[model samples]
Target: MVERGEPVRLCLHIGMPKTGTSLIQSVLQGLRPQLAHEGVWLPPNNLAAHRIAVEAFAADSRLSTRADVEAIREAITFEEAVAHSRPTSEEFTKVILSSEYFQQCSVPLLLPLLEKMGFSSEATSVVAALRRQDRILVSGFNQDVKAMHRSTPLIWDPDDAHQLDWYALLTPWAETFGKDAIKVQVFDREVAKKESLTCLFLEACDVSYDEASVTSLEVSRRDQENASLPADLLAFKFVANGVTRPGEVDWLIDEAQARGVGGGVYGLAEETVQAILEHYRMSNRQVALEYLGEDGDLFDDVVTAPTHTDLTVDPVILSSLLAICVAAQPRAEGARNHHLR
Candidate 1:
């Protein structure tokens, strides 16, 4: 929120995916009404995260034409009175636009689009949360398998290793919006739980609020945003993906999330883990020095590479999981739930 006679602040929480994005989006989305009362607004893209903004921007970023910009506008702006409401420039002291894919906005389209949306560059800042590469990769792969509607088993591709390069990831944002405009937070699950991610996000944005109340605010995670399946269930779902319709498979995905059956997305040997980490070590270090003002490693948690070679679930867990799948309600083909939105 802005002070009297000061510019209204705009905070764009672009994501480096899988770094508690769901939880962050969930918390902010849950707090939208409360935040609105305080003169800080998070606009809705179909009632939750504004992921379409980045997709729209990326579309224009590709073609670099005036028509592409209009296409971007057409993609994100809803003229229907019954659709999502946006605050007028005078309505709010501060505004937050968020989407995990926003980190990918490199071209000039984003800033000009925001200008059209009534946010000036001087009042805008970019906020991001970065996860350790190895963990995010595994989690990202699990998500791709679960929701990407993979016709074949989704395997983590080596090509995606470039995604682990934090330096490369953030550089475009810095170039597009000056380095000083970027605010970075290193993702720590333990710390986030201890001090709610919502509060952490507010702290990052310099938004004022009652921390206790903000932390206490609760929302249902029924859509199971970014929930991962345990290796066994993941394997079951992966196999089923080969044979079943995407909708038919949703029942197991939903059930697995509800029961909290989650584990390592992939069993990695120590050598493999070390290889992945070592590959991106420098990129992360650059980010630490350039953005976080820290020295050495960007992440400090102890790395535990799963040592088990067997992918099979214990018989009992497998049986229970299968039974739940059998008894679970099937969604109509092509149906998807967006309870959080």
Candidate 2:
């Protein structure tokens, strides 16, 4: 239990997505009751409050249209009400909030929401798991391809500049919360040897673990919360996204999953991967030296060449995706006809 006079600590895990965030969130959510018993409070009302908070902040921007602002304001009001109603029990020593969207948020945008949520800058400890740039780009691209509203083709041109700039992303948080208040962990397999991402996150939250605790927190091997699609399936989905409605595309993805279409992670060209790594090399090194106090490279290994298999869509998978598009044609035609009328 928290001492009567001390302020509550907030463990804010702002994710750099594709760094096993979903897995961590799922495990934390599952272990909420246990955590509460141990004086760690996970928000009961909103399991994913940070995501909604970030979205609201984005929509509330002046650059957004009035309708968007109003809608987001309504959402913010609802979330604020929920947060206020939550128990302010003194038994709780810490609060845990995790969301990948928070990584995209600026200090001005994020700080206000944290204040509203009853977390002070002085008491909050921000944690971010950083992945290597080349790998992150591929994962981020796959995510975009899988998204409903994303329509642009994925490109790796030097001019296009990927947003996996760790230095820029971390600076605001570090400056606001103090360098020591922000903990940076490398999201690599070798780094997390013996312990899983779930375990590493729980450790960061100051949660103790025994054999029984480990057993209780372990997610099943079969469960894939936000697993990336195979190269072939990803390619098919990328092309199919252009023609099909979001709903149809979702069904197609489910069907592909049902058919066991996954092989391994999608790969980018070697030259493209090298170019991206070189782009962020200095920034990554700076982050490591300043935040982590490591003189060596931030990444466990450099991307000298492409690591995964080529992005070749299997013939059978391509045919299946084409069929999905064909099936959606009637609905598309009906919508077009209605618009004409």
Candidate 3:
């Protein structure tokens, strides 16, 4: 438990995406003021502050520019200002920073940046939520289609050493922060049945979700929080991406959603799913034993392999494709009209 007068503890929620990360961020951002009152600080200036901080430290040439530096500096200044404004009786006990992109950052680069932000390595804890590999891959593929607007699936090499290897992903942080400092929670049905992802996360951060916090969250709750594209919509988007200009994808997504054309799940054959899982089986065991302190399977349930063939288009998905084609016509006509004029 965090003591009120202790030096601020920084909690970094680095994500392995498709693990309810966006919802967690949305809830925290929405309840920032109430959380601050409770002495937990989720910086308001840039929700992606940690992402930018990681990029800036990794020296991504694009983010290393003066503008990026100033942006991070501004965020730091804002956090400090917020810290100072708290009532004299309470000092911030924890600072929560989240970013899914931090999963890509190396610990060597990430640690120095956290130190610069007033976090001591000893006082910081890294929290991550992980999903089964098969589910993660399918969800990642869907995210690429929806968020990245990719016409084709992202490159997948079954033999690739790093992709989807839970152990590899967690090892660096465990090595640096010590295995005890790293907390891993399985994102599965059993956990979901007991508590929400938001609540699970708050617990990990040592933040209390008292009656007031629950009421505030309920009041501001969105009907859809980081909802995924329905499989049919996802399939339609996949096909549309092949022909549409990159800049036009967002418009296409918005138009499709407006028409109420959605529903479909990306799937893999049982053999394929099992094979992929086997590839990471050993690493997952290590992670479970070493970091999670679990002797059994890392995930609570085995992924239910799909009976149907992968990426099979059924009647419903076909209908969604038709809707997308019809939706694109108006945009195409408008573009032609502008050209003629």
Candidate 4:
């Protein structure tokens, strides 16, 4: 908790997406009780990452509806927490709000919201965890497919839609939150050193975990959620996506997982990977000098080459998709009849 006269520090972690965010959030949630004892509040009732709260407040066709906003009872603004943090709170010295949506948000849209919430620029900080542009693109495309957003495969046209510009993304935040208040950590580098992205995130927020109790929290590769589908099935999934309902995608994903093909499966060529990074080369350099204060590149220029350019699917999975279609035909007809009635 803050002393007799200290402003509670507010930390906003704007996720750039597809950068192990789900995994990071999972770790923080697992250690929530320990963090609470240390005066670090993640909020009770599984509100740590706070996606719904963030979605409710900032409008860019904001995700949450008015009903959702009201249902949460104004947790979007952290009303009670903000009020309690005034002068001093015997409760918490720091508050963290995180969401991938914030990364897509602009300063003009967000500044007013923060001011209304009683957090000043001086007491607030922004933390961004970045991954390689090419990696993010590939991983994100897979996620989109898994979610049944579309059936089309990723087209290799850098000009059509490009990778994220780190400089463009962070410079605004740095200018608004102060250069010192903006914390940038390379996701690839940190993952290489430590097993837990959560620990790295908390460290960026200035929360110590060395002495904390984490006997209950566990992390293993097996349990990491939102993993990309196996690379070999990319083409098969693209085809199945055309015929399957959105909800059916989960069953397909579960079957893929059961096969244990694992995620981070390569789905792009080495040349495509290089081209994607090249598109963002200069912007990344500016971010390195300005945000990270480093003279070198923002991330290591490395590419994991795809195993095969020609797409192939396991016969078993292909057969399963056929069976699913066959099984659904009667259900579809029955639903049509019901609708007609």
Task: List the candidates' TM-scores in order.
Answer: 0.78, 0.80, 0.78, 0.78
Q: Which regions of candidate 2 fall more than 4 Å away from where they truly are?
A: 1-4, 45-48, 55-87, 159-162, 189-194, 211-216, 221-224, 262-265, 302-314, 319-341
What do the candidate models score in CA lDDT, each in turn?
Answer: 0.65, 0.70, 0.69, 0.67
Q: After superposition, how far is residue 110 of candidate 3 from its true place, in Å?
A: 1.6
Put down candidate 4 lDDT per residue, 178-264, tens digits, no spaces.
Answer: 888998888888767755667677888999785233323434432655767676566566666788766666665565567554333
lDDT score for residue 104 of model 4: 60
> Which candidate has the highest lDDT of all?
2
Poorly placed runs, candidate 3 (over 4 Å) = 1-6, 56-90, 154-156, 189-194, 215-224, 247-249, 305-341
Error of 3 at 130 (Å): 0.7
lDDT assessment of candidate 2: 0.70
Q: Which segments of candidate 4 are over 4 A away from where they belong?
A: 1-4, 45-89, 160-163, 211-224, 261-264, 310-316, 320-341
Worst 10 residues of 4 by lDDT: 213-222
Strongest candidate by TM-score: 2
* Least accurate 10 contiguous residues by lDDT in model 2: 63-72
Q: Which of the two, 1 or 2, has more TM-score?
A: 2
Please give the distance, in angstroms, between residue 268's alpha carbon in candidate 1 and its true position after superposition. 2.4
